[model samples]
Target: MRVLYTSIFYLLLPFILLRLLWRSIAAPAYAKRWAERFGFFSALTTHKKVVWLHTVSVGEFLAALPLIRRLQADESVQLVITTTTPTGSERVRATLGDSVVHVYAPYDLPDALARFFKRVKPSLYLVMETELWPNTLAACAKRNIPAVLVNGRLSEKSARGYTRFGALTKPMLQHLSCAAIQNSVDAARFVALGLSGDKVIVTGNIKFDLSLSDDLRAQAATLKSQLSNDGKHLVLIAASTHQGEDEIILDAFAQVRASSFAWARGAVLVLVPRHPERFERVGQLCASRGYSVVRRSEHSWNGASDILLCNTMGELMLMFGASDIAFVGGSLVPNGGHNFIEPAAWGLPLISGEHLFNFAEVARLLTDAGALIKVNSAQTLAEAFVRLLENDSLRVEVGNAALRVALENRGALDKTLLVIADYLRKS
Candidate 1:
């Protein structure tokens, strides 16, 4: 099965490159780093122990930011980081510039993996979440490098997909030195998928262990003031929205603003699309709906703009902190949802759609704690917004719940660091 899979992958390589080229029409960065994907970057020559950490994209990098910083404090290892997407690479460059040796991750082909291993020659590899690749794992095993899966999660939908290719998936998982899973359910899923019980430990989610500086909070306040044009404008942020979700969110925004309540009438909706490629389309979509849109990159958001289109990178945290209500997107249209941890950490009341399978446990915790509100349609979403807007105390109650839940889950970062330290010591 492994050989067959490799052969099939080799056969599909051209089509994959072609697809990247096609996608580059909208996201040009995809076309820029072809050599890096083939593992042709300059080799590291550091005498210190080298550790490589891979994050697929921005969300994972943001989630692992605290952990990455923690590792940086220990100068014994030369930290090398790789991101699969250009946006992710951009984030790594912008946030922790020169702190780690950043590069694009090599493709899953054996040749690319061999080149990557030869260049970096890392002692330990930490891959975030579900970024498991068969060839990558096989290379790590062959090299005797400890590859740990940090903040691991396995949804049932993903489990079924893995079950389909059990032969390939099983050995791929077994190659891991250990998996620091997010929850017991995910840990159980790893065991079912062929990871040894002792090799899988539930370390919770490091996202909950985020560190927000006082400066960031002040920046958030300043942004809120600017968006409101120094007036009293109720801000409702629809964050990380997907393709099919923006329309529904706009409809909800319209409904919310049309309500008889004066607060609703003066509300400003901050729309942030999930991907950079969709930013222009989303802005046009808002304009088509007769809403006055403000692009963050073009100009500052003011009182005249009905929707603040957040097209900038690395500012979602500020947006979350600036808003009174948050609608975490991707859940509305079966995209399995993005992380709601950021907004929750800000003590903001969150609303999401029914499709939260990817974050099932986290959603359940927030919902059970009376922090998260679930909605299925534009009408329900509007009602959720109106309910909180009309009752300030209700918003406060939910927000407090979210903050408490986030604080209660804070030790995950420490646990995750301990696990990494243990593995690094062994290797």
Candidate 2:
């Protein structure tokens, strides 16, 4: 199965290169690092006693940060973090500083994986989330590098696809030395998909351990004071929004502005898109919605502007600190939703769409605790925003509840670190 997978991957190599070329024409940044997939193999050969961690993109890197930090700190480990996206590599560099080596993961071709393993000679390979590449797993197993799936999750959508190719996927998963899952449901999914039950351990979600440095918090406070100098009564933060979600948030903001409540008169909406490619599009969307938009990428925020478009990267946590109420994106349009815990950690009352399978447990806990509002449509979302803005008492109640939920779920980092430590010792 592994050989067949590798052969198919190589057969499509030319088309993949053409796709990269097309993307480069569409977005120059995507094209600039076209050879990054091959660059990993080059870097791997130079590093000794390498411990490679594979993540698909920025979110997974952030989710696996605590584990990365622990591995980097270990004297026996030479940490190598590989991400499939440019944004993920950038984030790993920013977050890990000088602690780990960052590289773009090689494509799952046998030769590429072989070269990467030969160069890095990784003692242990850790994969984040559900990025299970058959060739990569087979190559790691062949090299005798114990591959572990850390903070792993198996979404229903992903499970269906894997089950369709169970002959290939089951053997790949069974090769893993351990599967540190996010929750019991994830463990069951992995077990049903062919992983031994003993190999899958529920470690909870490590995203709850998201750290906000004092410097970052201070910067956010400074930006908040500068942006809301005249004492704006409310700041509605639309965070990690996807395509259509921004439109709904903008409409909700306009409704809040037109409300009869005195506090609604000076409300501001901070719109943040989920990806960098959509920054300009989101800014245009905000402007089209009749908002006087201020772009963060321009390092300019006008206090008089009704909306602030955060066109920057890796600063959502800071924005969360500056927000009064946050609408977590991805949920609004069935994108499975982004992390809501960052805002919750800052005691910001949260709102989201009904679709939150990505962070279902967090959403459930927040909803049960009255820390978050789950709305089904734009009208319901608008009403929730207005209610939170008008009723300061309700905002306070929900905000405190959110803080409590965040605090209660703070130990996942410790548990993940212990698992990585055990792996290192055994290796």
Candidate 3:
């Protein structure tokens, strides 16, 4: 079954590169680093224990930052961080800045994995989230490397997909030394999909362990002052908006402005699309709806535009800090929701659509705390915004509750570090 899977992957290689070429038309960064993907990067010369950490994209990289920082304190281990996306690569560079070995992850083909293992020579692999590959895990097991799946989450949809390929899935999971899952429900789902029950433990979500710096707080304060126009305008930021969700958000914002309240009349809408390729399209979408727009790239923000389009990266938390209310996107569509943890950390009242299987545990916590509101349509979204906007006291109450939930959920990072300590020593 594994051989068949590898053969199928080999046959699909050209189509994969073709799709990569197509995506590069929008995001040029995707075009570079082809050699690294083929496991052709220069070999690392390190006497220290090599620990490879894999984070597929920006979200996972950001979520794993605190853990990465903690691991860095161990001088005995040489960290080689791998990110599948260019944005994640850029983030690793921008934030870490030569502190670790950053590289593009190798393709999951057997030959590529073999070449990668020969070059990188990792003794322990910390695979973040759902980046399990049969070839990669097999190579790790063959090399006697302890591969630990950190901050693991197995959604029901993904579990079903894995179950369909149980022949390959069970062996791949059996290779893992351990999996520190987010919640018991997700842990049970992983066990059901053939991960050994004893090897999986519920350490809670590490995303709850977000570290908000004083510098970030200061930046948020300055942004809030600049965006609120000296406390006159009600600032509402819709963060991480997906392709389909933007239209609903724009229509909902229009409806929100229709309210008789003075704050609603002068409310400012900040649109931050999920992907950089869609930044121009989102700005254009706002203008097509007759809303004046200002891109963050323009660097001329005077609070005049109806929609403040965040065309920049790595400033999402700052955006959340500057906002009075936050409506997290991705849930509005079928794409399982994004990280609503940042907004909740910033103590901003949260709103999202119904789909939240990816973040079911975090969603439950915030919803129970009265910090999150789930809206199904534009009308309901607008009503949610109005309800929060009209009652200042209610907003403060919910925002405080959100912050409390964030604070209460701390220590996952510590538990995860403990879980992986034995694995790291296996080197």
Candidate 4:
């Protein structure tokens, strides 16, 4: 089955390259990293054995940052991070600077994996979330490199899909030195999929351990003061919005403004589209809605724009800090929403759509505590916004609930680090 899988992947190589070229039309960074994808890059410092940590994109990259910092502190290891998206690559560069090496994760073909392992020669491999590439794991196993899946999660839907290919997936799971999963449910799923029970442990979600730095809070404070003139206006941020969610958010914001809600007066809406490629489209969308808009990258808000388009990257947490009310996107559409951990940590009143499989447990924790409400449509979202804005008691109640949940759910980082320490000790 693994052989067949590799053969099929080889057959799809052309289509994959074509898809890269297609995406490059919007994000040119995709075009420039062709060599890296094929596992062609200059060698890193060969003096120290590299500890390679792979994160798929921005969310995974952010979730891994705390762990990466922890790993970097160990001067015995040379830390290198790999990301699949340009945005993640950019974030790694901006956040870590030259402290760690950043590179594009190679395509998971055998030859690519071989070349990558030969060049990078990682002593230990850690993959954030549930990115299980058979070729990559096989290569790691072949090299006798310790490979652990850190902060791992497996939703039921994903589990079912993986089970369909148990022959291929089981060996990959067995190849993993450890699976430091987020919850017992994920641990059970991994074990059921052929990972030994001893190999899989519930270490909880590392995202819960996310902390807002004083510097970030200060930046948010300054931006909030500048934008709202020190609480003169309410700030509504629809963050990580998808293609369809922006239209709904704009409609809902318009409805809120037209409604009799007193807080709607001079309210500013910030639309932060999830992908950088859609930044221009979102900016145009807001403008087309008759919103006077200012891009965050331009850094010149006239204090008059109805909508502040956050075109900048690596500033979502800061923007969330400034929000009076936050609507996390991806849920509004079928895409299983982005992480709501930041908003909860910031103690903001949160609203999301009904679809939250990606963050099912986190959403449940917030919803059960009255910190988050799920809206089904634009009208409902508008109503939720107006009600939350008008009722300070309700907003405070929900926001406080969110903060309590965030505060209570921390310590995952320590537990996760313990798992890594065990792996290192055994290896």
Task: List clashing residue pairs in candidate 4.
Answer: none
Please write out the lDDT profile of model 1 over residues 115-181, one tens digit for every residue.
9999999999999999999989999999999989999999999999999999999999989999999
Each prediction's TM-score versus the true structure:
0.98, 0.95, 0.98, 0.98
Please write out the lDDT profile of model 4 over residues 273-375, one tens digit for every residue.
9999999998998889898999999988867778889998998999999888999999988898888889989999899999998788888889999999899
* lDDT for position 330 in model 2: 95
Candidate order by lDDT, highest to lowest?
A: 1, 3, 4, 2
lDDT of each: 0.92, 0.81, 0.92, 0.89
Lowest summed-lDDT stretch of 10 residues in model 4?
418-427
For model 1, state the Cα shift of residue 317 in Å. 0.3
Task: Compute the lDDT for candidate 1.
Answer: 0.92
RMSD of 4: 1.1
Clash total of candidate 2:
3
Cα deviation of 34, candidate 2, in Å? 2.9
Model 2 scores a TM of 0.95
